[model samples]
Target: MGHADTLLAMGGAFLAAAFFARLGNRIGLPTIPLFTLAGMLLGPHTPGFVLVEDAHDFEMLSALGLVLLLFYLGLEFHLDDLKTGGRRLALAGGSYLLLNVGAGFGFGLALDWGIREALVLAGVLGISSSAIVTKILIDLGRLGRPETRLILGVIVVEDVFLALYLAALQPVIGGAHGVAEVLFQVTKAFAFLLVLAATARYGTRLIGRLIHVRDDELLVISFLGAAVLVAGVSELLGVADAIGAFMVGLILAQTPSAARIRRLVHPLRDAFAAIFFFAFGLAIDPGDFAAVLVPVAVAATLTLLMNVAAGLIVARLYGYGPGPAADIAATLLARGEFALILAAMAATAGLDERLAPFIAGYVLVLAVLGPVAAGRAHLVVRRLTGGRTPDGPDDLAPVEAPERTTSA
Candidate 1:
């Protein structure tokens, strides 16, 4: 397409996203799914306006969206919060991965798609979309709630797991059989994470000085540069770009300019994030979903059950009631970008033909369902508990526990 046509298509996409999201808001629906639906309706995959002939046209913008989404999430997540729930976060995150990933692997094997296909499915169904979850929390106005901390913490944990998981899976999928090669990949990934963690823990002041500036415009440029640069470096190192951006945000969050950076980045994050989800929808061919409907249904059902069970377990670990448990489950139920990435990897590796469509359908189902479920979490819990809701404040407030003694 010509430059003018590209501009026009982008403009159409943005407007369509805004219109659908507005309509969703009127009906009390979350914007993430609506934005995706907008892309699907207008994309080349479907019979419609065809905003962009290829989703890859928006690939870089979509990547920026993902980076900004995670970056903002990290900015909101203070270092103090991480320190407070370190151990619980590890346990909760580990439990979530074990349940979802283990079940997903077993499900894939049951499909008889092959062991490598099962590995892809494990990651696809196991990891939640951090971008979608971040958007949902903001849109639902639940960012300040106590449960929100756990949700974000769990996502961070998941991202870390993803780094290690991808390293190990890449060799298997690529048909690399050497034990030394696999160990090297794993060690490289682990070392990268360690370096970033150390930086976040101790290099905040240096980073702060580097990015600090009198003008908001300059500061914005500085931080954006840092995020994108680090994301690029991460991708080169076989780590996910989103994690690098997130780590940058986490480190900057400790600086005095954290609030200003957050303020400046909010609008950018929202706009780019819309493009991210829209591009995701644009890539999906709804025609493929028909063949994988049964598998999608089964996978979706399994995901929902596993997520709820994991959420309840985490809630109990943290001494939260059913209400919080419901919230956690519903919020974490969405599988998205990571699933798509895995499907693409599988396709590239000549794995099972059915895997891509299954994942696409599964992500579509949960992306829409997850946000809806989160919105109705309170009502769902109330109904299940016979309409006896938890007492005042406890529903949204952090319960006073020994583990939560540190102040936010």
Candidate 2:
């Protein structure tokens, strides 16, 4: 198709997705699934009503969207939490990741999907939607609740884990095989990450000094240029492009120019991120969704149960009572953009064809259900525990136990 035709197609897709987002907001549903569903409908694989004219162009744009999304996620990384949260945060967050990841892997094995696809599925099911969860916390006016604080700390831990996880996943996704080669690739990825981290830690002062452009236009261009350059280099080194972009974001997060960079890049991230989702749906055939729906339902149910249990364990470890514990669990239930990103990555890498649609359906289910469940967590907690909802000022407060709580 011609350039004008592609632009028109892109514009129409964005407008339709925007309308779906508005409609979701009106009905108190999450926007990610709405946007995904809209794309599926307009996609060539579905009724073929409205097609994106040039799939290759949209795919390139989608890749840029993924890089920007990862970069933004990196910028939001919370290093300060590691200091303030100390051991409690470590125990809670570590246990949460391991438990959920284990559950997902086991489920993948049950489906006989093999080790490679299982790993990818584990990641998709394990990572909570940081973007959606943050929005839920703010919208519900629960940002200051004690459990909410712990939840945010856990998300920071998840973010750190995901960055490293993506690094490790790169080699595996690149068709690395056998125990020795896999181990070697994993070691290389980790080594690269460690070297990058050390550089960021020691060279922060130098980076801070160099990013002192007074002109907003110059600063924005410089920041984006550096991010793209780093991402390109990372790909050249066999790491994923998103991983490279994330590292760049992490480096900038430490500099004084972090806020300025965030302010400028956020709008760009939002714009392209939507394209990423639309492009994902465009690649999926609607006919495949039904075949995956059963697994999606099963996986969603398992994640819901596991996340709640994990949240309660974390909350109780931090000395929170029943009510706040429920809040923490519900808040962690969201799974949206990151899951889609993983599915897209897997698709691009040519993993199991079934994995993509399964992920899309699974995310769609949870993205819609998570917010509603979180909003009603108090009632759920009360019903489950056979106790009235706490209404006092101290109800949402974070309390520490007299003794340190250890992970089970």
* Residue 135 in candidate 1, Cα distance off native in Å: 6.1
Alpha-carbon runs more than 4 Å astray in model 1: 78-80, 114-116, 129-156, 159-177, 320-323, 336-356, 375-408
Per-candidate total of colliding backbone pairs = 0, 0
C-alpha lDDT values of all predictions: 0.78, 0.80
**Candidate 1, 192-265: lDDT as tens digits:** 87888788889988888888899999999999999999889876775667777877887898888998998899
Q: For residues 87-122, could you state the per-residue lDDT of candidate 2 as single tens digits?
A: 888789888898788898889888887777888888
Pick out the ten consecutive residues of candidate 1 with the lowest summed lDDT. Answer: 399-408
Candidate number with greatest TM-score:
2
**Mind sharing the TM-score for model 2?**
0.93
Model 1: what TM-score?
0.83
